[model samples]
Target: MGTQAIIRPTTSQTAPAQEQNFGDQFLHVFLQDGTPVAKLGCGGSHVLNAAAGQSISNNRWTPITVQYNLPVGKQGGSCMIEIATDNGTAQRLEEYVSHPVSEVT
Candidate 1:
């Protein structure tokens, strides 16, 4: 059995002020072959892929945590996914970011 965490903005009017127009930004995390994988999307486009051979065991219950630092003026934000098991070190599964872009006139 595997688990997944999907992080995305809610509806436009219902979303928080900071995320209203950025509803198209999303991050997906899931377990594959006992490993954690991630995919990032922005503006309805799949822009980043970090899923690879990162493995975790399915033998015991593990605690997973996701953290994010919201973007600041002209700077990007980042999200980190981690998993920890009893008597083991916490492992970082993935890190996704929303990079800043140049403005076009």
Candidate 2:
């Protein structure tokens, strides 16, 4: 089974909490440390370098998609990410992750 979410960031982005929780998140997306990121199972972290903060942090709704490919046995995991910036620029990434997709996802 799969899951989906729609996030429309309000123009009110304040500093993220010093201790952001990724513990049980399947797809955790946030802008802490001035960088935009999307994390996977067990909240495996990855940078969404496609769009800059100014491009995404507005009242405009930028769409981002993340898909996980679970690991087999001892093999690692991978993810497919796509983002459409509010400005007509499109970004996509398909890469493997250092950690396996945690069931916690």
Those runs of model 2 whose alpha carbons end farther than 4 Å from true positions after fitting are: 1-4, 14-25, 32-36, 41-54, 77-105
Which pairs clash in model 1? none
Error of 2 at 77 (Å): 5.2
Tens-place lDDT digits, model 1, residues 11-58? 232221111123454455555445544444433342444433434443
TM-score of model number 1: 0.39
The TM-scores of all predictions, comma-separated, are 0.39, 0.41
Summed over model 2, clashes come to 0
Give the best candidate by lDDT. Answer: 2
lDDT of 2 by residue, 1-105 (tens): 222334455555543211224353344456543334544443345433332234455444444443344333334555554433334443455566565545533
Model 1 spans with C-alpha error above 4 angstroms: 1-22, 42-46, 51-54, 70-105
* Whole-model lDDT per candidate: 0.39, 0.43
